[model samples]
Target: MNNLDKVKKIVIEKPLKLDCGKTISNFPLAYETYGKLNEKKDNAILAFHALTGDQFVTGINPITNKNGWWSYLVGPDKPVDTNKFFVICANVIGGCIGSYGPNTIDPITKKKLATNFPVITINDMVNAQINLIDFFKIDKLFSVMGGSMGGMQVLQFVANFPNRTKTAIPIACTASHSAQNIALNELGRQAIMADVNWNKGDYLNSECSPDKGLSVARMAAHITYLSKKGLQEKFGRKLQERDDLKFSFDADFQIESYLRHQGSVFVDRFDANSYLYITRAMDYFDLVKQYNGNLSNAFKESKAKFFIISFTSDWLYPTSENKEIVIALNAAGANVGFIEINSDKGHDSFLLDVPEFLKSIKNFLDANYKIL
Candidate 1:
């Protein structure tokens, strides 16, 4: 095959013991690949996805009929440059889009796992990925890159497989969530549980699903993805259709309409129980604690080149928070590069049409990946 480009559904037979003392014998993972692995097996790169993202990192998404989420950065001539490296993106263990989550069929019961699914952590997620990487027969990944929750996985990969990753790029995320972010996630879950049709995460057994609750949750979480300046610049308290206030509770402002649309469309695609499982995984991701409260020790064995990026207006994961990681990397005496791009787009800037950010990524990937 000129390009090993396709989605692969794989199952690991060996039991993987999670950090929480739980063990799973057969874990399923969904992954997509692009370009071809060199005969030397040194050109493979694994790209992690954000909280709601899937393994469809490039090309057309069959379900959505839209371009892959990271198409801007991962195509043949794009920043990641598939012409040079083989890229693989795997859906996280607790994700719903074809991965083993609440929606997966439980062999024992012959039914969906639902609330019965095992609680997964970021460490568990990376463990599953390590299995997938082993299946690909690659001794080491050339680089691993991701942003937001995906970025959390990148750090987890480095922490757990220090020698396996040659280059690590974590962008727009913290090693752990702040109390405030945890609170926001809690609010989303509460919204879902409050719906009568939730049925405590077993809604699949019933005719009713918590569509409304899930929509509200998505609406709430979507706001944190943008900057205050971005919100003002895009909507700015502007009235929707009438150009004047509607006295009733209808969506009078453009931002309200925008959020409602986002929520509605999200509910059509995502499942409520899957949302709960994945968000809980993100909340429990704490790298420093995994290394006994010393963040530097987490990277003690990391020989990978590190390039960390953050956005200036991203309050969700502000530059100061990202610098904590950079400082820790320095303490570990690792090769690292840190940059905070000045942007009004906030945390979503990495996904948007930011020229400077894209340029920086292109430069970083080009410099870090040297042909062996």
Candidate 2:
């Protein structure tokens, strides 16, 4: 078996008290690693995944039979360069993929937690990751990197554990979700719960698992991931399958067909309850609140070098949001660098094959990180 095939499964028992006042025991964190940790354990890099992403970072996901989510940016010679740095990617605490999620069987009830799974926040996810790092005996991380919700975790990590990281990179993310963004997430949740099969999020044993509702939720959110120009260019008035519009309920526009496919495929690989939990966690995130309402105070004691990147077209969390983070870091006297990649791909550009994005990362790591 290759290295990816030798993947190990680890489950960290949750502590009695979580940051959110929840008692979660037997918390499982599913993760995978590429390359090897050096003797000093100084070469470790923690790669945080976005809202819908799982532990599969640079290899194929055996569960879904699909390529890893961020494979474009993480291989042997890619920007992350697994050949040198030991990369660790884990599904967040409320995630479904092998992690203890709403879908996991609760030892007490002998059934999946489903809707009973305690509410989790972004801080809870980062705290779980900190536990994993502690288990690995990695006292400090060489770098912590991510985008979107992943980027939120990156910032949370630095704020919560300033001494544990050497470098921090949060891409295309905001310190807190805007009211409009929160409203969008709420609508998605409402769509899922609106399905009669939802049964208050306890639909694991139902005949059909709210697939339609989840599909609609995914479709709605996926629209936010792309730039308006990208959507227009990729599929505007173009008809789907047929040259002429049916003008009925059938999908006529190519975008509708594309979104339908996205929704259908997403349902197959993701759990609706997990989606609800993760999105709620993201919506509850506000890093500045823990810092006396001063965003800069969040990084007052940080020693990590910071790299914040944003895309011009990502209105979901535009460049201005990134600048706010950069400004705070600067006010705190933290060493920081900011870059805005000019792209029409919107928030998803970082995950796609963007040469300049990769180059920026490569150059940053080469110049600052020591290779041992």
Candidate 3:
């Protein structure tokens, strides 16, 4: 938080009316960029971040001292090949990493917005980031891509601004949030609220934080990111530095320790309130309903080419959901391609080092860019 001002950002002078009927103005939208935008500016690619992911897509994240979440893909000579394309990523409006969110202080009140922050939707997030496009004076983006919640934003972006991008890649995401996923998110939310320290999402001014509850939430959600096969192969019933169980409540298996470590580290870099607001936005996403049950209508106006990708083992979004988008694109007569990469890594496969998956993206972007 002390280094927040150090993050690159722009203050949007235009008022943004959120889906919850609240209007926000003069808010900061933090972002990070890679490579350079050529004279034509057609080399620009907008990359969206998933849940809990900030704008740091590649290289070292100065805030956490860890590798950026997408370091494996979006770098010089990598799949995205920032050397050839200028990649732009922004912290979604409901995000905590220097973006306007619950942790952001109200300039008027001089207090953290906290629970007073109005709920935002995926549509609102895309609308807020569009200001960045205008700020840079890019007439049309070369590409827009993301996975999971990031993918949802890609869909929303195209729907809102059909002529803004040349290509769209929505990987491992759905047009609408499924009931099961909503329930899973609710489970995480309950864990946070159960912590007395949460204090109804107004704990910013307090000394104690709801770290225990947040850690448990992360542990539970992390399981969904992996496949049963992947988990078995990686951890199995392996004991954690012991020949036998400790016979107590402490972590006895390697898997337990792994989950605890993930949860603990996540709490350090993330704000609990941001997690709550972002998940709620994901749940409220329903592109089909927005178009009156015809998902095809969502993209009917977009001439941009689309490429949807999915993993074989991703049960969270699953191949079915990704295919649905392809099907809708087909119905709309939009130029679209679909691929299901074989992987045991589950929903997080897109974020990992999967050669075939990376290669496909490179081929798509490179081939498309050449045509331009």
The whole-model lDDT of each prediction reads: 0.87, 0.87, 0.95
> Which pairs of residues collide in model 1?
none
lDDT of 1 by residue, 12-125 (tens): 888989767888877778888999999988889999998878888988876566788898888899888899889999989888777788988888788889999888998899
* Residue 182 lDDT (model 1): 93
Candidate 3 wrong stretches, greater than 4 Å: none
Point out where model 2 deviates above 4 Å. 1-7, 14-16
Residue 129 of model 1: what lDDT? Answer: 89
lDDT of 3 by residue, 220-284 (tens): 89999999999999999999999998889898999999999999999998888998999999999
Clashing pairs in 2: none
Q: Model 1 misses residue 321 by how many Å?
A: 1.1
How many residue pairs clash in each candidate at the backbone level? 0, 0, 0
Q: Alpha-carbon error at 216 in model 1, in Å?
A: 1.0
Which should have the higher lDDT, number 2 or number 3?
3
* Superposition error at 268 for model 2 (Å): 0.3
Q: Among these predicted structures, which one has the highest lDDT?
A: 3
